[model samples]
Target chain A: MPYKYIGRTHSFKGKTLWEIVGNLKNFGVGRLVVRNTVVERYPEPSYYRILKVETLPQPKEESLDNLRKVKVLLEKTFRGVTNPKPVCIESASYKTDYRLIPKDEEQRYCQYKAPVTNEKIFPSTMELPPLMKEVLIREMKIKGEPVVEPVMDIVYNDKKRRIAKEGEKPTIEIKIGLGKPAALSLYKGIKLE
Target chain B: MFALNVISKTLNLPATKSAVNFQILRWRRKPRWVPIAKSKQFRIPQRPVIIEDEQIELKRLFNNYRTQMKSIKRYIVERFVAARAITTDPKDIQRIFDEDFARCNKINDEWNSDIQSKRIEYFENTLEENINLAKESLQKRLELEQFKLEEAEKIVTEQKELSKTFITADNIDEAIERSLANPVDYNFAVDLDGNKFYNKKTL
Candidate 1:
C-alpha cells in the first residue's frame, strides 16, 4: 500500500508530516523527499516516511548533468526498490491528520418476547422510579464558541412523606432518605463546531 | 521567472524559499513623545488583510462559482424561452419542463458521479499508499524487534558459552557491564533515517 494522509488537518502540533515539493516557478529542485515521523518500533526500525529533496545548486550548469546528478543519487539510494515509483512533480503535499473514529456496525437486534409485564410490583414501599430526559443544545454555534465538555453524574434517592389532611389543620411531613435520585446525565456538546 | 541551469541532461530549478512576513505590532497611543532611547511609530489607516489560507480558498471558490453561474445563464434563458413559447398545448410545455428538469438532474447526477468516482479513486490511492508505507514501517519494526530479541538471545547464549570458556569476574553482570561499556553490536541499535554520514570528500 502507498502512504496516504487521513486528513489535511494537523490537530496535534509538530507531529505532522510534510512532503517536499519543487518550486517549479523559480528554482526547480532535482529530487524531493517527504519529511516523515520516525518509527522506533522493531523487528525493524519504525520509519516515518522521509521524502528527500535535492536540487542542483549552481550558476546554471550548461549540460543535462543537473538531472543526472539527482538521478544518480536516487539510483544509488533506492537500489533495492523493485517497483521504483515516480514522484508527483507538480504538487507534493502530504496530509497530517488528527485521530479518526472507527466506522459503526450495521443495525442488528434480536427480537425476543419475554413474559408478560407485572402490573403490581414494588421493590420497596419507599422507592422512586427512574426518569430519563433527552436534552438538546438548540443553538447556532460560531467558530470560537467555547467548548464545554459535559459531565455526567448519576444519583439515586427515595422520598418519604406522610399524608396531609387540611380540614383538621394537619400539616404535611417529609423525610429525606439516605438513597439519592438514580439519575444519569447526558451532556449536549457544541454543534456546528 | 528563473534562470534554468542544465546539468547532465537534467534542468536545475531555482528553489524559492518562504520569506518571513514582517509583523509590526501596533497599538493605540495618545500622541506620546519619545527620546533617542525610544522609537515610536505612527499608525496608518486600518484595512483588512489576508491572514489565512482559508480566506484565499473561499475567495477563489466564490469567484469560480460566480463565473460558472454567469456562464450557466444561457441554459437558464433557453429553458425559460422553451417554457414561455407554449400556449396551445399546456401538457407539452409541462412535459418539456419535466423533461428539461429530468435532463438537468441526470446531467447533475452524472457529473457528480464522475467527480465522486475520481475523488474516490484519489482517496483509494492515497489510502493504499499510506497503508503500504505504514505496513512497511511496521514490518520493519517487527523485524528489528525480532532482531533485538535475537541479539538478546545471543547474549544469553554467549554468556553460556563463556561460562564454559571461563568463569568471568562476577557471574554475567560484570561481563555484561564491560560489554555494554565497550558496546558491541547487540543489533538493537537502528537508525531509520538512513542518513549517510556526511562526508566532505563526497561534497
Candidate 2:
C-alpha cells in the first residue's frame, strides 16, 4: 500500500468478477461496504447481504478455494431464499475503488511466470502471466459519474405459495428470507403489474 | 475464462462441473475489533479502534459471514414458516422470526475473534507445509495447455495423411456396429456413459 496524490477507478464484468471471486476463493477479503445509494433504488435487488469467508495466513491451510467453496455453498443453499424478488447485488473487494484506481499502476498485478518463449529449445522460458493488475490507470482517467446501474440481482423466494384455493384469491405474506426484513416486506407489497 | 481453465487444470478438478466459486468481502476498513478486555458494564462503551487493515485471515472470516447470512436466514425462515403454519397470530410470527434471528446470530458468535485467532494460527502453519509439498508434486506434471490454434498444428504434425477412416462421424465405430447384421432382428448397442441412442434390443 503506497500513499499517492490520487486514486483511480474502473469497471469490469464477467472475467473481472470471476478474478476477484477467484482471488477470494483461496485467500480472504475484508468486509465489503457499499454506498446506501447503491443498495436502495436499485430496482432489481430486493434484499442485500454481503458475504465474508474465512482466510488465515498461517500454517497456510486456508485456501482461496475455501472462499470459492463457501460461495458455492451460499448460492446453492440459498438459491430458494431470494427467488420471486431478486436482490440486486453489487460486490467489490478493493485495494481501492476503480475511480481511485490511478492510471499508471494498472498493469502491475503479481506475475506468476514470464510469458513463454516458443523457440522450443526448452520452452523452459515459458511462464504463467502474473495475476491481473488494476489497469485503468495507464490508458484512461478515472472519471466520476452517476453510479452504474445495478449489476447483480439475487432472488430470495424459496418458500412462496398461494394459500387461496384455485379460484378464491388468497392474501398471503410470504417471507423468503434474504435477510432484509424491511426490503422484503416492501418488495412483496408493491402491486405487481 | 482463460484463467478459470488454468485454475481448474491446476486443481485437477473438472472445470465448473460441481464447483461454485464464492467471494469474500470486508468492510472498506478494519472492523472495530472489540477490545481484549471483555467489557462488564454492557461493557464500558468505547470507540472502535480504526487501525490500518492488517490480518488477511480476519478478513476471510468476515467474507463467510457475509455470504452465509442468506442460508442462516433461510433456516430461520423455515422454522418461522413452520411455526406460522401452526398458528396465524402476527405476534407469534414476530416471535418466531426473533427466535430465528437470535439463533443465526448465536451461530455467528461461534466464529468470533476469540476462536478465529487460534484457527488462523493453525491454518497458516499448515498452509506453509502444504505449499512446499504441492510445489514438489506439481513440478513433475507438464502444465502446458496448447492455445486453440495450436490444435491444428498438432493435427498436421501428428498425422501427415489427414484423410482418415476413423475421423469422420459417418465412419464412427459406434454407428457402424449398430448396423443390422442379422436377418430379421438386430442387437442394440450403447456407448460408455451408458446412454442408449436407439434401443435395438427387442421387447
Candidate 3:
C-alpha cells in the first residue's frame, strides 16, 4: 500500500482548496461533488419510487434488476465528467506469478509450465526522473503551519431518579442478633419531631 | 705358770692372739709359721689443712642467717599484711571477686554498645543504599514506559499515513467529528502545573 498524507481543506475566494501534505502522487486530481438535474416540478417526485426503494424488501432477482437500473442511471449522469477523473476501485484477487496449466502434455515431464513466454507480467519499480525528483523535493520542503483546532464544549445535567416507589415496603425480613448494650443504644439519637 | 696352763687346758680355751689369727685366715690349713712383710704397700699424698679464723666463720654464718632471715621476714610480713589489711574471710573474697566482675562487665557493656552503634550506622547506610537502588530502578521503569509511549505514537502516525490517501477535507472533517463524538470515553484533566492527563487510563 502506498503512503498517503491528508491535509485540511479551507475556503479560499469562495472555492474549497484542499492541501496535500505528504507524497504528491495524485496532486492534479480535483475534489468530488454531487449535482442534481431538474426534470419536472409537480405534486411530488415519484412517491411510489420512494415507497418501493426506501422500504425493506428481500434483494432477489427483481430487486437486483432495479439496483442495476439505478447504477446505470448514476453512470449515465457521471459519464460526462472529464475534469475530475472518475475513480475505479480495483477488486481484490489472488495475484499469481504464473498461470497454471492442467492438461498440457508437457506436464508429465514438467509439473508447472508457463502459458506464454515469461514476459514480465507486472511493471517493475521505477526510479523518479531527475526533473520529477527535483520537483518532489521542492514540494516536500514546504512545511505546513500549525492551525488551531476549535474546542468542543459539552454540558452535563443530573436528572437521575430511583426505580423504586416512594412508599415501597421491604419484602425481606431478617432477625438481627444484637447485644444488650447495642440494643439499648440503637434508638438513642432519634428526635420526637 | 704350771697351775695356769693346767687351767687353760682344763677349760679348753684359745688365747686372744690365736683367736685373732684364726679369724684372719679365710681357709683352714695345717698350722705353719709365716713372717709378715712390713714394707710400705701404699703411698698416701699429704697436704697441710688450713683452718679458718673464728670471726670469718662467724661472719659467714651471719651473712647466711641474714639472707635467710630477710627472706623469712619478707614472707612473714607479706602474710601478716594479707591477713590484716586484706581479709582472708570468704565474704571479703567474694566482694573482691564481685568488684572485679563488675569492672569486667562494665567494660564488656561498653564494647557491646560500641559494636551496637556501629551496627546501627552500617544498617542505616545499607538501607540508604537500597533506597537509592530502588529509586534508580523506578526511574528506569519510567524511562522504559516513556520509550514505549513514543513507539506507540510512531506506529499510530504510520497507520494514519497509510490510510490517508486522496481523502478530501470533508471526509477528514467527518473522521475528526466522529473521533470527537466518542472522545476516547475519557476526560482530559489538567493538573496544577497545566499538564494534561487522561482520567481513565495511565499515559
Candidate 4:
C-alpha cells in the first residue's frame, strides 16, 4: 500500500452535493440522489428528486478543499413514503454524504414496496392519581351527586400524519400501572413485590 | 519569595506583601482560535474496550430503549394528528365565548356591588366624622371670637373712663390755667430745732 492511515477514519462515503450537482448537465435537475446513511438504516428506498438547483457563491478567502453549500428544491421520499410537497435542502447540502442514483435504476428504486406499520390504539382515558381520585369521590358524595369512576381523557398533540391508524387493532397495549422493565439487570437488587 | 516577586512582576499584579504566595489558577478550556498543540495533532483516541457479554447486554438495552421511544413518539404524533382533525363551527365557538363572558361579567358585577356597598358605608362614616370635626372647630372659633370681643370692649370702657383727664385742643387754655393755679414753693428746709423755712432767701 502507498500509505497507511494513522488518524481516525471518517464514515462518509459519497461526495458533497455541490461536487456531484455542479458537474452535471443543467445542474442535475430531474435527477435522483440518496443519502447513504439513511439507506443503511432502513430497508426501503429513501431519495430526493431534484426539481431546481441554485449554486451559492463561494467566499474569496475560502480554500478549494472547503465544503460549499447549494440550495436545491427536491421531492423527498423517505423509507418509500413520498412527501406530498416539495422541500428545499440548503444547510445539509454542505454535508459530503450524498450519492447520485443512475438513471437506469430509477424504475427499480420505485418498485420497492413501502413498509407498513401496524396501528396503535392508545386508551381513551387514564386514571387520576390515587389521592385525587379519593378526593373527587368524597366531594361527589358530599354534594349528593352520583360518583362514577374518576378517569381523565388522554390528551394528545395535534399532527398531520397520525401514528394511531383508524380501524385497526393496537399492536401494543397501554395499561394503567407501573410499566414492566426490559431486563431484570436494570432493577438489580430492588424488590418488585 | 524571589519566584513570587518575579511572577507578580511578569503578570503585572500587585507585589506580594506577605510570606504566602497566592496564585490564581484558571480552570477553563483553551479559546477556539488557539491551534491544537503539534504533539496532540497526530494522537488518536483509543476506543473503549467492553466485554462481549456486557456489549451484548448494552446493545439489547439500547434497542429496547430505541423501540420504546419510537413507539411513544409515534403515539404522540398520531394523537396530535387526530386532535387537529377535530374542527368546531365558528358560530358555536362564538356562542361558547359569549356564554363564558356573560358568566364572568355576572360574577364581576356581584363583586362590584359588594365593594360598592362597603365604599358607600366608608364614605358616609368619613363624612359624618368630618362634619363633627367641623362643628367642634367652629364652636371653638366662635368662643375665641367672643373672648376677643369681650377683651376689646373692656379696653374701650377703660379708655372712656380716662378720657376726662386727657388734654384736648378745646381744653388746652383751661388745663394750663389750672396747672398754674396749683403751683407750690419747693425751696423750704428744716433746721435742728425743727423750724420750717418757707424760702431760704427770706430766712
Candidate 5:
C-alpha cells in the first residue's frame, strides 16, 4: 500500500503514527497548531472534495545558496555549545471547501422545524396560551407601558432592605428564579435539533 | 554604456585574464535639485479647498454606462441607415431596441467572463509567488538555527580535545624554556595607549 503522508510521523511499536510534539500535532512532513478555539463543530463526520491541485515554483538557486551559507555559519558558531536537532520548516495551504449538501437534504434539514406535531402548529405563528397570558398580566401588572418602572421599584426596595439590615447587622440574600409558566413554555417543546 | 579594455596579444603573448572588466560610464546626467520659483510658492489660491463625501465611484460607473449606451445608440442608427432598413413604426423601433439590448447584454457577459479569467490567472500567479517567498524565508531561518548548533558543537569538541592534552608540571619548565629560546618579534607594536601600530619595514 502507498503511504499517505500528512505530517511528521514517528514509529511506535510497529506502526508509523503521527507524532504529537508539545501542543503541535505533527505528521511526517507537516504539523499544525490550533490558532483559535473550535468555535464551530460538525455533529457528524464530513468529507471534502478535492477541486484543483497546483505545484508551486521552486525557490531560486541564489536564495537557496544564501540559506546554506546561513546554515553553515550557524553550525560553525554553535557546534560546541549545543546539541544538534532537526529544524522543521512549516507551510500550510488553506483548503476551502464548499459543503456540497444535496438540494433536497438542505430543504429537509437546513430550516427551523417545530417538534413533531399531530396538529398544524407553525412555531412562528404560535401564540401564548390564554391562561398563561392572564396570569402574567395579573402577577406583573403589565399594561404595555414601561417594564422599567417596576424594575426600578424592585431595586429601590432591595436597596432600602439592605440599608435596614446593615443597621440590624443581619444578612439578607435575594435569590432569583424563573417563573413556572415561563420556564415550562421555554423548554416544553424545544429538543435542540 | 561601458568600454571593454582589451590588451594587445603581442604585448602579453596571451590574454592574461579570461574575463575582461568593462568600465561603465555614467550615461544620464546627474539631476540637481532646483528650488521652486519663489513667486509660485507664495501665489494666492483662486479656488477654495472643499472636501465632501459622495458616491464618486458609483457615479463614474453610471457615467461610463451612459456613454456606452449613447455610442450603441449611434451605431445602431448608422447601421440601420447603411442597411437601408428604414422604418418609422413605433413597434418596429421597440423591437430593434429589444434586440440590441439582448446583444449588448451578451457582449457584457462575455467581457465579464474574460475579466474573471484574467483575475483568476493573476490570483494563481500571486499565490505561487507568495508561497515561494515564504518557503525560501523559512528555509533560510532553519538553516541559520542549524548552523548555530553546529558551530556550538565544534567549539565544545575543540575545547574538550584541548583539555585532554593538558601540560604536566614536569613539562611546564621545559615549555617555558622552549618559548623563551624561540621568541618571535611582534609584527605589530602596541604603544602605551593600547592602540596597535603596524611596523613599517624599511628597504
Candidate 6:
C-alpha cells in the first residue's frame, strides 16, 4: 500500500544546513548556502558562505527529525553587501530552508555588482511652529534685538545602517503641516472642511 | 390558582428559564503529546493563492513603506541624540550651571521681595489692631474700677447714717433712763380697719 502524507504542508523548500553539510567532505566548508525565504523577499542575491561546521551530539531517545542545534560559522552577504563580521548560525540550523549553491553558479553570483542609487538629501533645518515663531518675534522686539525668523535645526542620530544620506540640495523637506496623501482612493469621499 | 393557570394557558405564556453553567473552550491547536486524529491524519491544508500583479504591487508598496519608515526613524533618533547630547568640556558645563543658577537666583530674589513687602504690610496692620485692642481693654478696666469705687462709697455712707442709732458706752445711762420713762409695750391687736389697740398693765 502507498504511504499517506499527514498534516498541513510546510513552506520550506530546501534541506536543512546539516543535511547538506553532514554528507559533504570537510563539513561543506567554503560553500555557499542561500535561504529560499530570503530570496523570495529580496530581488538581490543573498547567501551565506560556510566557514566551519560542528555537529552536536544527538539525544538517544529523540528522533533525527527533532530539532538539533549545530554551530556553523558563516560569512553573510545580504542585498549585495557583504558583512564585515563573521556570524554564527546555531538555532536556525534546524530549519529546513537552506540550499547549497552549485560551484558553477557561485562565480555568476559573485559577478553581480551592489546596486547603487543617488544619495538622498534631507532638510538640515525645519521651520518653527506658528505660535512659537510669533512668541519669539514678540520677545525679540521687546528686547530691542534684531528679529530673525526662528527655525529649528534638524539633527540626525548616528546609526549602524542609516537610510538618510548627506548631500547638497535636499530632496526631502521636513515640514510642520499635513503632507500630501500617498493614495487618493483611501481619502475618497472625504472633505477637509 | 386554577383560574390563573387557565389564563396563563390561554395567553400562551412562556416558562422562565434558569441560567446555564458552562465552560467556554477556546479554539487552539492540540498539545504536542496528543497524536493526530485518525480521520485528519491524511488531510492537507490548502495554500492561499495570490495574483502576480497584486503581489508585485504589494511588494513595491512594502519596499517604499520600509524605506520611508527607516528614514523617519533615523531622523527621529538623530533629533533625540542631538537634544540630549552633553558638552564634554567641564568649562562649558560650569558656564551653563552658573547661568542657570543666576537666573534662578534672580527669580528667587524677586519672589522674596514681593513676599517681604506683603509681610511688612501685614505686620503694620496687625500691630495697629493689637494696640487698639489693648486701649479698649484698658478703658473697660478703668470704668469697672470707677463703678466698684462708687458702689463702695454708697455702702459706706449708708453704714455711717446707721451708726448714730447704735447704743454706745457713753449713751448707756441716758438710753436706759429713756427706756424706763417710755415703758414700751410690744403686744398689740389690730382690727380689720387697721386700728391698733395696745394692752397696758397697771404698775
Top-TM-score candidate index: 6
Q: Please, what are the lDDT tens digits per residue for candidate 3 over residues A1-193? A: 9964333332222111111101122321221212111112122221100001111232366431132111101111132222232232111101111111122432242323334543222111122334534554565566453432211111112224222233543332111121122132334775422
Residue pairs in candidate 4 whose N, alpha carbon or C atoms collide under 3 angstroms: A157-B80, A158-B80, A159-B80, A159-B81, A162-B78, A163-B78
TM-score of each: 0.18, 0.13, 0.19, 0.44, 0.20, 0.45
Candidate 6, residue A53: the lDDT equals 87
- DockQ value for model 1: 0.00
Q: Tens digits of per-residue lDDT for model 4 on B64-106?
A: 4554445445655765799666349989789878999999999
Fnat for the candidates in order: 0.00, 0.00, 0.00, 0.19, 0.00, 0.19
Q: What shift in Å separates residue B194 of candidate 4 from its native position after superposition?
A: 64
Which parts of model 6 have CA positions greater than 4 angstroms off? Answer: A1-13, A60-66, A129-145, A155-167, A177-193, B1-203
Q: What is every candidate's C-alpha DockQ against the true complex, given to 2 decimals?
A: 0.00, 0.01, 0.00, 0.13, 0.00, 0.13
Task: Specify the poorest-scoring 10-residue window by lDDT in model 2 chain B.
Answer: B49-58
Mark the 10 consecutive residues where model 4 chain B has the least summed lDDT.
B63-72
* Prediction-by-prediction clash tally: 51, 72, 0, 6, 32, 2
What does the lDDT read for residue A174 in candidate 2? Answer: 22
- The prediction achieving the highest DockQ against the true structure is 4
* Tens digit per residue, CA lDDT, model 2, A66-135: 2212221111113113444323322333222211112243233111233454321111111111221123
Which runs of model 3 end up more than 4 angstroms from their true locations? A1-193, B1-88, B164-203
On lDDT, the leading prediction is: 4
Give lDDT for model 3: 0.41
Q: Looking at model 4, give its docking quality level.
A: incorrect
DockQ winner between candidates 2 and 3: 2
lDDT of 6 by residue, A1-193 (tens): 9965556667888887878888888998998999889978788889999998889876566654685568899999998889999999988888889998999999897677756786566666666657767987998899999999876654444444233444555777666544444444544798632
lDDT of 3 by residue, B1-203 (tens): 55555556666766632222222335665457754234533433354443435444555456544543444455446657876787789999999989999999999999999999999999999999999999999999999999999999999999989876646776988777877898664578877999877754655
In Å, what is the interface RMSD of model 2? 18.0
